[model samples]
Every structure is written in C-alpha cells, then in structure tokens.
Target: MRYDFLIIGSGITGTMIARELSKYDAKTIVLEKENDAANHATSANSAIIHSGYDPDPGSLKAKLNVEGNLLYDVLEKELDIPLYNNGAFMVAHDKDEEGLLQRYYERAKTNGVPGVEILDQQQARALEKNLADDVTKVLNLPSTKVTYPWEVAIAALENAVDNGVSFAKNKQVVSITADNEGYTVKTEDGTTYHTRYVINAAGAYTEKIAKMIEKKVPYHITPRKGEYMILDRRVAGFIQRTLYPTPDEKGKGILMVPQYHGNILIGPNSEHQASLDDVSTSKGGLKIVKEGALKLAKNIPFHKNIRTFSGVRASSSHKDFYIKESLEHSGFIHVAGIDSPGLTAAPAIAKYVVDTIIRPKETLIDNKTFNPCRKAITLYDDMSAEEKSVAFQSDARYGNLVCKCERVTEGDIVRHIHRSVNADSVKAVKKRSRAGAGLCQGGYCEHQVIKILAREFGKTPLEINYFSDQSNILKNETKVKK
Candidate 1:
C-alpha cells in the first residue's frame, strides 16, 4: 500500500501518534507485528501514570510525563476509558530515606508537578492504615494515577481508525529501503508498504529497525523484564493508593498499586534480560516482589493473588527517551527506548512527533471528518436497572452471562468482538470486555468465551486461538461430534 505515513508497532506510542495524525488529511497506516494491539509492554505493566518527579529535570521523560499526565483528564472522558487519580505514596522507612523524599519533593516542584507534599509518619499511617510501622515519612504525589494501559492504546487506535487511519496486524517490517520517491517497507509475510514518512515506534526492536537503514544508529536498546502479581478484588480496599519505595538506580522499586478496576497490583521487580522475549516469571523474582511489598504495607494477603505476569521494557542505553528524526534517514522518526514513564508521556510524545517532526516536512491539511471520540464497550455490570431492562429487551444475549467472575454478559463479548479494531482472539476479547480477567482467571468462563467467539466468527471451536494464530485453545476433539 502507498501512504503518506507508515507507523511501525501499535503500542501506546505508535497508536497515540496515529490518533494524533488522524486529525490531519493524510494517508496514514499503523503496522503491528503482533496479532493484536498492545500485545507486549503496553498490555503488561504497573499501569501507573507517573507524576513526572522521578526523571531528570531537563530530560524528555520529565517534560512529556507532566504534560501527558494533564492530558488524561480529557482523554478519559473522550475515549471513555477508566482513570483513577487515587494518587501515590513514596514511603520512607528511615531518616536517610526521609531525606530522599525531600529531594524528590524539590524535584517535583522544579518539574512543575502540582500537589506534591511530604506527610509525617502519623499522617501517612492515618491515610493508609496498612502501611508498615517503620515508615518514617511519605511523599504524596496527588497527580499520580492508575489506568488500563492496553485500553488506552486500543481506544486511541480505535478512534484513529474511526477518523480514517488504517491499521494492519501481523505486518512485521522485515526490511526497509529509501529512495527519492519514498521508502519501501517489506514485512515477513511478503507484503510491501510504500510511504513517504516512516515513524519507528517498534518498542524493543526499535533500534534494530533504525539499523536497517543505517549501520551506525545513534542509540541502543537493552530489554529489561519486570515481573508482577495481581491480587483479587477482595483486596480492593486493602490499600487506598499506590505505594512505592524510594527511587533507586534500577528504577522505581517494587510498588503496590490499587488498579482502576477493583483489583490490587503488586511486585514489579525489575531485572535486565539477555533476550527481549524472555518474559517468563521466576520464583526468585516473585520472592523479591513479595519481600518488597511487605516493606511498604503489612499483612498483605498473598493467598489472594490471582495472576502473575511479566513485561519487557525497551530500556535505552541513553537513560532517557530517544525521540527524534533519524540523522541518517531524513523522513524516518525514531520513538524508542521508552521505559518507566513512557505510558504517561505517550500523548505529549505523539503531539511532538506529529507537530514538530512531520508537519514541517509536508503540507497536511485538516481532516474535516476527524472525530476523537470512540464509545466504550457496553459493560453489563455498570448498567443501571432501567438500562439493563432496555438492553435485555433489545438483545436477549444481554441476559446470558458468559463470565460470572466479572459479570461479563454475552452481549458485551459480541459488541467488543465487532468493534472498529475488533477482537479476533480469546486474549483480545479478554482485554476488551474483561470476560476472563476476574478472580477465576478465565478458568470458569474461557470455554464459554471460546464458544461465543466461534459462534460470532462462524468458526469451529477448534479453529479459535487463545491469543495468536499458533496458540489454538482446543488441541483436538476429545470425542467425535455426534
């Protein structure tokens, strides 16, 4: 396909850029290597929207984080995504750590982060009663928030697609060649895309994509893995706010996060990995996470843990976000090495790329039909009694419960299955409708989901995949169909 802009990777960075570009009159497409959007780091993480106090004062991470944090107020309403400004507490267990809290407070002020204050031990304990007894001080960042990171990326892409942006899944870029006319990008599936400007937002493999045109790229990416555990909603009110340890060189240490949903999240122990694909959780890593969580809060019911997962971060050697037009290639822009604060900084970074990097190079007229709003899926549990009765009258599927764990009705699953982006796989449906995200972790509802997907897509149960094309859920028919 020929286009004006071709964005690689459909993570938060790429999708946000696509949404931003959708406002302009241009032929733009986002190519995602995976079968679904946000299949990597965007899908798995702490989901914390950092308040911009941690990064170095003059760095891009700090600048964009604060700017992007402010954008969520509008984004939450426009996109219909859930956002909780429950705030965060950086606990100090000793006098030395209290000194560090003061330093962070000063940095927060310089970074233009509002509502930052230091609370005494009594004040901190009063707010979060479960806090460890040794806590000497606390840095309260009221601007810090929690959200569904994958939902943000999904909503952005959906909105962009609604406004005339094209999205192609499993289109991994294999090679790139530049010419006077434009650039040619070929994928592994033998499809080729010709575009005038290429935005490289390939996440962990961004440096490799940059090196495709230039042997000596400016930056390098080191994939670092972080492991986490999700506690059931029974522990929802166990911690009122996200709790963190003092900042360290490795990154913000393990945190106890109260998710936007009723669940609680804890233990994202950072560890550098030799390979980007190594997201397997380890006993040692979980142990580190458990130990770290205990320091900030007491009597954490580890038995309530529902799930354990990990995500690899595209940690750049430069120690900051690497966003700029390629020096060797004129039209190629690299949005790489986005790690800790990347999620929070995505909106600002997208604006910068579209306005600063791409606009000056070409004449982009406004897309008169551009629409920023993408209605959220119908959540059965959030409906009022009258609304539920009306919905049930319209579609009998609303009366059928597919996921009792999460109160996900068959109607919810079907609606998300046919969205602008569409949920083709079981995991995709789970991410969209929350059918399999509850305490049982799909154990009770997965088969029902599989059957519903099969019915909706006109495929046999055997043909349905758990996630990607290869990971089929039902291996074979146990007994021959009667």
Candidate 2:
C-alpha cells in the first residue's frame, strides 16, 4: 500500500511519531520487523520516566526528556496506562559524590526541571528509610516517575492504529532507494512500499537503515547492553522512589526503580558491544548491577529476585540524539542515537519531528476524526469485588482462572488477543496481560498459554513460537495412546 509516511520501527519513538502524525490528515503506516510492537529494546529497560536531570545541559536528550516528562500526565488519562510519579533520589556516599549531587542539582535547575532540590541526610532518610548509612547527601527530583516501557509503546501504537494509522508487522525494511518523487522501501519478504517520507526509527539498526540510502551515514551506533534483575512484589516497598548513584559519562549509574506494577527493578550496568542483537546477560554484568545497586539502597532483598534479563541501547558516537532531516537525503529523517532518556524524550521528540521538521516542508491538514482516548483491557486482578462480579456476569471466561499467580483469567487473555495490536506469541500475551510474568515465570501457566494461542490463531501448538519465529517451543509431536 502507498503511504504518505512510512515509519521503519515500532518502538516508542516510531509509535509515538505515528500517533502524532495520525492527528494530521495523512496516510501513515508503521512497519515493524517483530511479531508485535516493543519486541526489542522497548521490552527490556529500566522503565523510568527520567526527570531530565542526567543528560548534559543544552543537549537534545535534556530538552526532549524534560518536555516528554510533562506529557505523561495527560497521556496516562488519554491512553489509560499505568504511571507512578513517586519522584527519584540521587544519593551520595562520600565527599566526591556529594559534590556530584550539587552539580546535578544545579544542572536540573539550569534545565528547568521542576521541583528539583538538594536534601541533607536527615531529609533523605525521612523519605527513603533504607538509605545507606554512609550516604551524606541526596538530590531530590520530584518529577521523576516509573512506567512500563513496553506498555507505553504498545498503547501508543494501538491508539495510532485506532486513529487510522496502519501497522505492518514482521515487515523488515531491507533496502531503500530514493527517486525524484519519494523513497521506495523494500522489506525482507519481497514486498515494496512507496512513501513520500521515510522515518528511520529502527532501534539498533537505525544507522544501517540510513546507510541504505547512499551506503554511508554520518554516525555509527554502538549497542550498549544493560543487565537488570526484577525482585518479587514482596520487596516492592523497599524504596518509596527510584534511587540512583551519582552520574557518570557512560549513562545514568545503576538504579533501584520501584515499578508501578508493585515490583522492584535494579541494575543495568553499561557494556558497549558491536553486536546489535546481543541482549544476553553475562554473569559479571549482573554482578556489577547488584553490587552497584546495593551501594545506593543497602537493605535490598537479593534472595527475592525472580527474573534477570538485558536490553541493548542504541548509543551513537555523536553522544547526543541524532535527530534531523538527513542533510544528504531530502525526505529521510534520522531519529537515531536515542539512548538513556530516550524513553522519557519520546513524546517531545515526536512533536518536534512533526512540528519543526516535517510540517515546515509538507502541509498537513488536521484529521477531523482523530480520537486520542483508548480503552484499556479489563484487568481482573485490579478490579474490586463488585467489579469482578459484574465482569464475571458479563462473560463466563472471566470466572475461569488461567494464571493463578497473577490472577489472570481466560477472558483477559481472550480480550488481549482480539485488540488492534493482538498477542501473537507466548511472550506477546505475557506483555499484554501478566499471564506468564508471575513468580512462577510461566512454569505453571505456559501450557495453557500455548493452547490458548493455538486456539485463537487457528494454528497447532507446534507452530506457536515462544518469542521469535525461530524459537518454536513445541517442535515435534509424539504418538498418543489411542
């Protein structure tokens, strides 16, 4: 299908951009290589809405992060997503770190981040009782928040789709050629799409997409891996807000984030690598994460840890967001090198790209039928007793428990399967609903999820994949007793 704009990724940047563009009267399509949105870096991250205090002053990361942080309050109501603005603290354990906190406070003040203050030991301890004894000072950032990274991207993509934006999944852009009129993008499946504008938001592979135009792009992307550990919900209250160590050149130091879903997250030491797809958590990297996090919050319950994983950020050599219409290519826009505060900077970035970059070149009328509100799925676990009864009365599937650990019912799974961004794999369902993300880690509910997927998609259990197409769980069938 021909489109006015073709976005080459389905992460936060691309999906948010698509949602913003959908407000205009134009045909937009988002091409995602994965089976679902947020299958890559967006799925795994610290999930913190940064307060815009960490990035260097006057950089794109700083400007967009502060602006994007302010957009979430309205976005939460519009999209019906979870967001916890409990605030954040950067603790200092020594004189050097205390000086670092002072610098950070000044930087936040200069950047216009709201409610930033420097707290002494007594004040910091009053807010976070688990602060290490050696911590001398703390930088309080009241605007900091926590959110599910995948949920934001998926919700934005779904809202865009609801507002007339089309999404083509599993369509990997392999090549692009610019003609006199526009650009022609070819996918790995041999399908070609013609568009007036090509937005390069492909996380990790963004540089490669830019090079496809003329075989050379200005910047290079270094995939930096960050390892993390998720503790059980019992330890979720170990800290009242996100805790951080003093900043460094690499990125925000390993942090302790209290997830909005009543869980705890920690770690994410930066390890730069050349491989774009290396999300493997190493033994040493995770060790560094635990050691670093313990320094900020000494009372962490390490034995309560349930899951360990990693995500790769697209770090560019330029060290700032590489967002501009390619000087070499006319219609191509590069939103690359978006790391650290990229998630927090996404909304502002979308608006900036649309308002400052695209609108100046092309005139776009407002789409009159554009709707911003999206109804979220009915979660059985979060409802009251009366609400549960009403839900059960409406559907018998809600009465049947599919995942005991998370209290996920069959109705929840079925509802998520039929949405605009449906769950196609076991991992997709897990992300949509908390079916397989409980303490058991799908050990008890995986078979049920597989069966449900097979039934919903009209495919055999052998055809269903775990996450990717190549990772099919059920490979062969055995002879059953007749």
Candidate 3:
C-alpha cells in the first residue's frame, strides 16, 4: 500500500513521530522489527523524565529535552499513563563533587530548567535521610520525574493507531530505493512498502538505516550498554525521589530511582559494547552498580533485589541527536543517536519533524477526526471498591487474579491481548499489565500468562514464546488427554 510516511522502528521516537503525524492528513505506518514496541532501549532504560540539565546548552538534546519534559502533564492525562514528578537529588560526595554541583546548577539555570536549587548537606539530608555522610551538597531538581518507557510508547502508538495510522510488527526493513514519487522500502519477509516520506528512527539501527540510503552518511552508532537492578516494592519509600551522583562522560551516573508504581531501581553503569544486540547483564556490571548505588544511599537492602536487566543505547558518534532531512536523499529524514535524553525529548522531536520539516515539503491538511485521548488499561489496584465490585460483576474474570504480587487479574491479561497493540507474548503481557515483572519474575504467574495468551490467540502452551518467537518457553507437549 502507498503511504505518505513510513516510520522505521517502534521505539519511543518512531512511535511518537507516528502519533504526531496522525494529527494531520497523512497516511503513516510504523514498522517494528520486534514483536512489540519498545522492545530494545525504549523499554530497558532508566525511565526518567530528565529536567534537561545535563545536555550541553543549545544542542538539540537540550532544546527537545526541556520542551518534552513540559509536555508530560498533558501526555499523562491524555494517555492515562503513570508519571510521577517525584523530583531528583544530585548528591555530591566530597568538596570536589560539591564544585561539580555548582557547575550543574549553573547549567540547569542556563538550560531554563525551573525550580532548581543548590542545597547544602543539611538541606540535602532533610529531603533524603539515607544520603551518605560524605555528601556535602546537592542539586535539587523538582521537575525530574519517572515513568515506564514502554508504556508511554504503547500509549502513543495506540493513540496513533486509533487515529488511523497503520502498524506492522516483525517487518525488518532490509533496503530502500529512492524513486520519483518517494521511496520503496523492502522488508525481509519479501513485502514491499511504498511511501512518499521516510523517517529513520530505528533506535540502535538508525545509523544502519541512514547508510541504507547514502553509503557515506557521516555518522556511526555505538551500542553503549547500561545494566540495572530493580529491588522489590518493599524498598519503595527507602529513597523517596531519584538520587544521582556527580556527572561523568559516560552519561548520568548510577541513580537510585523510585518507579511510579513504588518499586526501587538502581544502577546503569555505562559500558560500551561492540554488538548492537548485546543486552546481557554481566556479573561485574551488576557489582559495579551495587557499589555505585550504595555510595549515594547507604542503607539499601540488597537482599530485596528482584530483577536484573540491561539496555543498549543508540550512542551517536556525533554526541548529539542527529535529526535532519538528508542532504543525499530528499524525502528521507534521519532521527538517530537519540540516547540519554531521548525518552524526554521524543514528543518535541516528533512535533519538530512534522511541523518544521515535513509539512513545508508537502501540501498536508489537518485530520479533523483525530482524537488525542486513548483509554488506558484498568488495573485492579487503581479501582475504587465500588468500581471493582461493578467491574467484577460485569466481567467475572476480573476476580481471577493472575499476578498476585502486582494484583493483575485475568481480565487485565485478556484485555491486553485484545488491545489496539495486542500483547502477544509473555514479555509483552508483562510490559502491558506488569504480570510477570514482580519479585517472583514470572516464576508464579508465567504459566498462567502463557495459558491466557494461548487461549486468547487459539494456540497451545507449547506455542507461546517469552519475548521473541525463537525463544519459546515450552519445548514440547507433555501428557494430555485426547
């Protein structure tokens, strides 16, 4: 089918861009290589709405970061997603680091990040009592927030789909040929897509996509790996807000962040990897995370560790977001190297691409039927007692709890499976409903989730996979009555 725009990758950047374009008279399609959105760096990162203090002043990252940070309030309301402005504390360990705090404060002021304050040790400890004794100063940023990155991507893409943008999953783009009309994108599955405009937001594979059009694209992507460890919800209130150490070249140092749902997360020591798909967490990396996190908050209960996972960032060699229409190809735009501040900069970048870049090139009109509101999945815990009784009466499956740790019901899993962007696998269900993401890590609810998925999709338990189709959980069928 011929489309006005084809977005490569279903990460936050691509999905957000698709959402922005859906507001106008454009036929857009988002092609995802994975089975679901945010399967790579989008789902696995620190999940923080940075207050735009870190990026160099006047860079694309800084401009978009601040603009996107301001949009979360409206986004959270419209998308019905969870976002907590729980604030942040950049702690200083000693006199030298205290100097760094002053420098960061100056940067924050220059970047137009509001409500930033330089606090001494007494003021810092007043906010977080568990801070290390050696911490002499702190940079208190009241605008820093936390969110589930994958959920945000899902909400945006789902809203876009609701507004008439088509979505295709597991379609890995192999090559693109520029034509007089536009570009013809060929996928690995022998299917071709014709589009008048192409936006390359393929996360780690963005540089590869750019090179697909121009052989010498003047930029490269390095997969910088960052490992993280999540503690159980029992450690939620231990450190109230996101806590950070002094800055370094790698990125934001180890942060002790509180998830919006009350879980505690730590680590993310920056380690650059040679491979784009290497998201495996190493033992040494976890150890370094533990040491680095404990240096900021000393009383964390390491025994409460629940899960460990890693993400590979799309670190650009250019050191800033590479967003611009290609000089080599007319209709091809590049949105690559969006790493650290990406999650926070996504919406603004999407708006910039659509309003500033594409609209001027083409005669596009507004899609009057566009609706920004998207209904979110209802969780058992978020409901009032009266609402719960009414909901359970309407759908008896709501009474059947699938994930006891997270209070996820069977109805929740079933709803996710049948949503706009259906949650097809165990991991997708976990991302959508938090079924297998608790302390047990699917040890208790995995089979139940697989059973629900199998029933919903008309498959057997053995046919269900974890994340990818190749990673099947059940190898073969056991004893079954005929």
Model 1 regions more than 4 Å off: none
> How many residue pairs clash (N, CA or C atoms closer than 3 angstroms) in each of the candidate models, in the order given?
0, 0, 0
The residue-level lDDT of candidate 3 at 272 comes to: 84
Candidate 3 weakest lDDT stretch, 10 residues: 210-219
- TM-score of the candidate numbered 2? 0.98
Q: What is the overall TM-score of model 1 with all chains considered together?
A: 0.98
- Candidate 3 residues lying further than 4 Å off, grouped into runs, are 480-482
Cα TM-score per model: 0.98, 0.98, 0.98
Q: How do these models rank on lDDT, best leading?
A: 1, 3, 2
Candidate 2's error at 84, in angstroms?
0.4
Residue-by-residue lDDT tens digits, candidate 1, 251-345: 89999999988789997998888897788999999999999999999999999999999999999998899999988888999998988798999
Query: What shift in Å separates residue 341 of candidate 1 from its native position after superposition?
Result: 0.5
TM-score of 3: 0.98
